[model samples]
Target: MGEGGKRKSRQEDAPAPPSHRILTADELGLLKVSEVPAGDKWEETAAKQRWGAPDKAQGITRLQVHCPDWSSDRCLVAAARTSGRVTLHAGSDGGDLGSFRAAPPASTSGRSDTSTNAVQALRFARPEGSQQLLIATATLGGHVSVHRCPVEAALSTALAGRVVQTWEEAARLQTIGDLQAMDVSSSGRYVAVGGEGHQLKVWDLEAAGGAAAAAAAGADGSTPKAGEPLFAGKAGKPSRSGLQDLAHVTALAFVPGQDDKQVLVGTAKHKLWLYDTRAGRKPQAELVWGEGRITTLQPQPDGSRIWVGNGRGHVEALDLRAAPAKLSMGHALKGVAGSIRALALHPSEPLIASVSLDRHLRVHHAIKRGSLAKLYLKQALTGVAWLPPLPPAPADGAREEEEEEEEEEQARAAAEEADGDAEEEEEQQQHNGRGARGKGKHAGRGKADGGSKPPAKKQDSKRRKQ
Candidate 1:
């Protein structure tokens, strides 16, 4: 064959390239953590390529990771940008998956528009028996909506999903607090929102007939029944000066194992409050947490530990099992030059990821003994999350089915052989019995011919004559 023909044949015989997905905890541990990349490198690589809008100098507003299940290997990372857009990125390679505009129309000119519905907080949740992930987002304009993200969204273009339900807060923007922070419980049954007016409220989605029921309730959807929240509390301490307290909640998170009843709240007044809905509307406990506003709170799976980040550039650990939940000095992580914006814990590892106003993403060992990795992004980062691993491939399932079928075939063949052997043995036994009977008959005939049979017949005739 000519050279061109041989090259074409070789190309056809080559193996296909591997598909990229989010890195598992084990895979992340294999990387060099201390080698920090330059800020310009992110502008050229992840920022421009993965996020698709390098001009969005306004940075990200919130980040969340969605996994169909804890055991699933496939995961998606969603980042809500200040441009009123939400973008999806692959967990494995930080590649652009897809994006959609979540809030009202806004420009991408690196300007923050106060009038536009800019996304302030977002969460990824999967309801029980759901095949897709639900993204709940709160905007600065007091708008809350739930959008359904299909499994195949990664393969589609920028607009990947549709809003399943939406509800507006009737409070005026100037008087009531805008929804600044929001969280959905692990069960995806409860959602809580809090902000500037020192107002905190929790909604039981399950009680509201769940996400499926709300979707059918129309675009206006259902609101938390006429101001009656499943749980509600205002954060702030009364002042001796007779002036109104200006404390507004800055961060909110549901306690992981508390049946969606326990909540951790952080306010602009440097306080942390824990509230249990089953107990009462008042906070179960309150503690002076930080010197500045608390920006984020990440609770452990067991709810015994919580990692907190603040505007003072500190990430501290709190032992919830303690009487008052004091911050542990030994576990305090520090080094960022700017305020810590968000914190995300690894699902199964001791690693924690954080993004800050310093425009850097840093991962550290949970114990504060080692730095795992750090990368610089040119613009300020408002949020960060560790994406889960991807799910098993279709080929793996097909292979499992093939092995099961082969085992079944082998079992059937063994049973058929055993039946055939038993039939042959039975036929041989029947033939032997027939042969033995024939021999006996022949022997009797021989005896009769030798006159033994005549003597018996003569005795019978004599008896009859007598």
Candidate 2:
């Protein structure tokens, strides 16, 4: 080929410089396109790779987040597990902080019996004017205990808290069956427990006089005489004919702003009852909520609405203002695959998180009832709780150390100036032929870098002489 032809080919191959190039709108945005997971189709390969053999001992049964009235920000999460232990996790990342056995050890084996000791329910509360955070755990074996959890205790293997109060269902009442649901009032003064059959009871912790009376009640950490419930109400029909099939309270919630005065109880008979303790023992209103058994009831912070989940894989937002009606229809939320075991509201956002028996964790828009995100957890998920967003960290550690270093350097400079001034005065009297008074007048003068400035004494002496 000729030299001119070769040169033309080389020029065509050379790229343009930045000044000669132009970018499209898509390129300017720096966006990249990626494929989303196929709709509703399980990724079998990914699931197998992510999850190992399932273990029932590690299965989480219930979750509760600590939220004091003074601070609604994200805090520690308590997870009740099948192994009869309540594990504490950091709300920010779901990291396991510590765990304590909620069930007593087997008397014969000296170890916990996981099968009979599985925790069924748990709640967190803080009393008025008190700084201690309390956790109450109820086991399948009809034993309940309350513990005081310190905020700074985060050791993974250490026990999290001490038992402050304890009671056994067998000791308190002979007929109250397995505890299915339990809740602490807003004031943390009263506790309510209900379960299979017509067993509904409330206990006043303040009247029991805390742990002093509890410890004296029994030697094995059992409350021999845990005082009678403040209000006890039968859940089902007054007639004895259908009582066997209708009288199971599966869920309970104390009204948010009611201060233990009002309670919402959900029964197996597909009925939601509003009980006013001050009025009478009978439920004030009975509204049919769903077709199946009510599994969980979560009230809003403002007490305006309540989120209800049932055994039929339905989540509904009920308007409390229109409640007590014979047949009330709540806005049904979609995208749930299996029966939801638990639901938790976000601390600040209008978002709710739920975990179901289908091994899926889902987050949804609370208002729109639209699915935000759904994740296949690959393990039977019994509970989910949202931790408060962690507070902004203080400017400490290295930053504080740097500040202290600066302060120390300034202090050292001042000490050096004091010593230097003493030496200067000595030198003036010994060698500089200056009068003692004249040298004494300069005592107040020092370098500003040493954090010392000239005083008004020297100027005052000069003014007096004038």
RMSD of 1: 16.4
**For each candidate, what TM-score against the reference?**
0.61, 0.63
- What are the Cα lDDT values of the candidates? 0.62, 0.62
| Residue 212 error, candidate 1, Å | 10
TM-score of candidate 1 to 2 decimals: 0.61
Where model 1 places Cα greater than 4 Å from the true spot, the runs are 1-51, 57-59, 68-73, 93-101, 104-116, 149-176, 206-227, 236-244, 323-330, 387-466
lDDT of 1 by residue, 100-135 (tens): 656544345887565546778888776667655677
Overall local distance difference test of candidate 2 = 0.62
Clashing pairs in model 1? 21-92, 22-91, 22-92, 73-389, 73-390, 73-391, 74-389, 74-390, 74-391
Q: Model 2, which residues run further than 4 Å from truth?
A: 1-55, 67-74, 93-96, 106-114, 150-175, 209-222, 236-245, 322-327, 388-466
